[model samples]
Target: MGSHIGGDELAVSNPTRAAQEISQTIFSLDLGGISTVILNGYDAIKECLYHQSEVFADRPSLPLFQKMTKMGGLLNCKYGSGWIEHRKLALNSFRYFGNGEKMFQRISEECMFFCDAIDMHKGKPFNPKHLVTNAVSNVTNLIIFGQRFTYDDRDFQHMIEIFSENVELAASAWAFLYNAFPWLEYLPFGKHQRLFRNATKVYDFLLQIIERFTQGRVQYSPRHYIDAYLDEMEQIANDKAASFSRENLIFSVGELIIAGTETTTNTLRWAMLYLALYPSIQEKVHREIDSVLNGRAPTMEDKQRMPYVEAVLHEVLRFCNIVPLGIFRATSQDAVVRGYTIPRGTMVITNLYSVHFDEKYWREPAVFCPERFLDNNGNFVRRDAFVPFSVGRRHCLGEQLARMEMFLFFTTLFQRFHLQFPQGSVPSLRSKLGMTLQPLPYSICAIRRQR
Candidate 1:
């Protein structure tokens, strides 16, 4: 009975319903000769992903996953010393460049460009989608390649479009089937082929940047992530066991760009949507920003004084639930989670949608209430179950950078303009699932505020 129900649940796209149908916290499915387990409930998820983190820290060998990530990349690599070494190297590099004053200044400048673009809408109803995407992706570009592109750059736009297209294809039902049955790859005529083609384009684009840096025509001062990685490779050049190979470098750059861009872009887009839908809440957030900054530019330090703004952002992440299914994981060995024995090499999926919207963890999960994240003194409160970035050892490496971008971009935008849906059109909270849960294509009007 558990197996049948679990199989049905896995077949569906809506994770919330799948969690509801399963009576047990952990449900196992025989997915095309692979043993897969779906973990629901906060406690069950915590145990599998957290308490027994090592037992479930590897990447699954799915066909679509292999094509999309190659499992050679930092994001989808198998659990082992190679993954650990690269992860640590990437984290240190991020730390070296991530929180520097120069980085923050760049983000602020990008936000200015973003606000300028929105202001171009002339108070008329226009879709802020591409504008936001350009600005958000520019920040990632700066981090990865130490450069930003003009919004009108056709090559850059095409690359982003390809990246976006691949993300949507990843969420399609075809991706699910391909992952389950690897034999589908040879049959031809499916999105799986397009995914590989796009992957090649993305890798080629990334490699050009690396080749430029390595060709010695450009001075290398270890300016950004790519340069820093090259420095590491030089230092360990003689070490045969070093994981800092050219292949890892290429994929690591891909990981940083893809991971950093889409999720942050989607979250900021959702921020505008929610603020537009709830004018009262929007006003409250605006008041907080206005009071704290006093018309000056926002700094990370100002985050403490603006509790309501922080709460609203947190609420947005919770409400949006971007990356609902999250990155898939595989077991390192046989493990017992919540009294269930999940075998070795099994695919493990922690149903984040179930945990985020579970009534047991939240008071009113469906309602967009930022107050739930605030305490009696109206201060921000952190909830353990608020795992938008996922939990445990294999959590998102970009968590800190993402938070910085979201808070800074969000506050700056709201500080400059009042976001609302276009005239005569209702704000639709509909989301189209992809690599992330993106807000459906919608137009929003940003009315500039008077200082």
Candidate 2:
């Protein structure tokens, strides 16, 4: 039996009912401002949820997510025809900005810098949070502004820290208050107000960059995302149908930076935890890397050859809950599921953790088994349950970039060194729950593997 989402009081009273089939009990009242929609035993079914996106495609009314997002800045935004227009342009923006070419090049270079920065902490258990955060943010910087920063760059690093701090508030108590009564933000002692101020700073920073980058030739001439967006704004200069203003461009780019950065960085951090905890698994991955390319850094093409290595990456994302409960989605219109008709504006969430760990779909779902991704024929076929990036129209825009960054950053570091938890400190699997369920912070030494 599964529980259904109702109003706030019902949710608060019936939260354990929402925990359903999960072994790790959820603290009631929705930490991140939406209750978990437990799927129970129905997860593997094709329409495990019906009217899923149709009944629930609106972004939740959380002031924290909404304000930070600037009301559906991109991914977690409400589902509407407006989304179609925005997503199409956003997808085009990815290409126009040379997302696959110059962007990937910047990603590779910045990721290499990440590896190098980690390499600097050689033989010392290092807290990689800030360096990794900066490294991840730089790829977005490259895409949005054609700029990349060293891990130690003060200006970018400060932006990264502030952004991280502000987003983390999404899972805090005040986030719920802000969502329930957005007016609370203006009240004294409200941290949400401070976050709004910081968000304004970030927005201003983006505006400044847009003001700087848009200088020179016709807006669309360069064919970059900003250029193209600016060109559209010029065409629709007076049209109400146009959301193609310079602020939109800045916010969209800023959205990419915020959404894209911490996730890949956190996943890398979790991968490190997995490596330290399971040295043999680490050895096997390194061995695969060694055998396939002989000390060369991994590439997307190399994934076809290194099956085990690919599986390791999958397992890392599966086990690491970077986006817990996935991004909130609400019903755009009334729709029925299992004979129950959820009304319009009904908020919905997919069971991201459940989908990853459902027993029917996985063998030893609780264990870190990379072999699950490989079939008897040993082909790395995509699993239906791999919805870490979400699915369908609302899928992540930075997925390809994330995959590429993870592969390069991860494989490069493994090529140069092996990591170990500090002396007498055991690797902890106990996750510190956050907006993403992060593994508790711990340091590890990257001892260079002798060639």
User: Which of the numbered candidates is closest to the native, going by highest lDDT?
Assistant: 1
Candidate 1 stretches greater than 4 Å from native: 4-24, 214-221
TM-score of each: 0.94, 0.87
Report the C-alpha lDDT of model 2 over 78-175, residue by residue, as the tens digit. Answer: 56655665678777766666455556666667767777777777589888777777887776666666677776677667777777777676666777
Error of 1 at 349 (Å): 0.6
Best model number under TM-score: 1
Residue 405 lDDT (model 1): 89
What local distance difference test score does each model get? 0.82, 0.69
TM-score of 2: 0.87
